[model samples]
Target: MSDATSARCVKCWVHGRVQGVGFRYTTQHEAQKLGLTGYARNLDDGSVEVVACGEGEQVEKLLAWLKAGGPRSASVEKVLTEPSQGDPTWTSFKIRY
Candidate 1:
């Protein structure tokens, strides 16, 4: 998708060894690199949940990277992505509580 049409948003659920590492931080970096605005957070179930809004290709790239295991120490097992609804008004990516 072109950057213009790619303004579509995405929300992802990442599973596996994604907690206690630098996943959130790394995700923030990646999101910033892609010019995405959203949040990443550790789920109570030991998974990482990421919501990003930006170009479709960039969002897909981020999802692919996360599926391949994030950063150096992450062991991602699965990644589920879906179209996001509503607006994305985040000024910066953050590690949500």
Candidate 2:
């Protein structure tokens, strides 16, 4: 395993009522608060995809928060998590196009 593998990185696909909402912003805020680094983007399928990396516990906490959906106006129906590739350095979380 590489050093990247030693660090915890979680890739998640969040579906249901996530787009057109503040989910991305809220997710960024939450991830930053947890000291995690990642990016969130709106998918063409109307879902939100996120990739977060940090300490094991912190990454898990970020995933859990995403599972609960974001702030008001967003309804997260499902959250699918998986391992990501490479070690992407994120200075700050942002919404991707």
Candidate 3:
């Protein structure tokens, strides 16, 4: 299947200065711009967790963005990504509280 038509989901944990830096909001914005669906939220361990589901290429783009560094205020030190295991149910990207 083409990258544009294939569906995929990736769960990423962004570490290092991700919290308190508008990381979730920025991730939501980026996901929306890429037409991906899922959620971003602050984790208890001072990291930001993101679940991106959509076309394979879009998901990869989000991963790349996470690895390259997030929002201007965010100092991304590491990004860990894995294939999401659960069903893809999100219809829109959101910043979860």
Candidate 4:
């Protein structure tokens, strides 16, 4: 288990064939399972934006999943990630509009 005191946040923009394929829902489910707190939302540009926050290890796991092409039906082309503080007010993983 990762040390919660060393938690970090990341914002990922998943591109290519990611919209309308249950990506956000799957992301939320995976993040929640990892005990992460954040939100996944669809972008107008046809990508998916995910903000995840949690212990470093868990966040890394989530990133790996994202890099692997997201959910079952997603045809991920590229993923862009950056360090983010995310929402300090978030208490759980959810699919945001």
Q: What TM-score against the true fold does each predicted structure earn?
A: 0.88, 0.86, 0.92, 0.92
> How far in Å is the alpha carbon of 34 misplaced in model 3?
0.5
Which has the better TM-score: candidate 1, or candidate 2? Answer: 1
Compared with the true structure, model 4 gives a TM-score of: 0.92
Q: Order of all candidates by lDDT, from best down to worst?
A: 4, 3, 1, 2
Query: Candidate 3: where is the Cα deviation over 4 Å?
Result: none
Ten contiguous residues with the weakest lDDT in model 4: 1-10
Please write out the lDDT profile of model 2 over residues 15-59, one tens digit for every residue: 999988888988888888987777899999999999988877788
Local distance difference test scores for all models: 0.84, 0.82, 0.88, 0.91
Question: Candidate 4, residue 80: CA error in Å?
Answer: 0.3
As a whole number from 0 to 100, the lDDT of residue 60 in candidate 2 is: 78
RMSD of 4: 2.2
Model 1, 1-97: lDDT tens digits are 4665557678889998889889999999999998888899999999988998877788778887888888888888889888787265577677787
lDDT per residue as tens, model 3, 19-60: 888888888999999999989989899999898998998999
> Clashing residue pairs, candidate 3?
none
Against the hidden true structure, what lDDT does model 1 obtain? 0.84
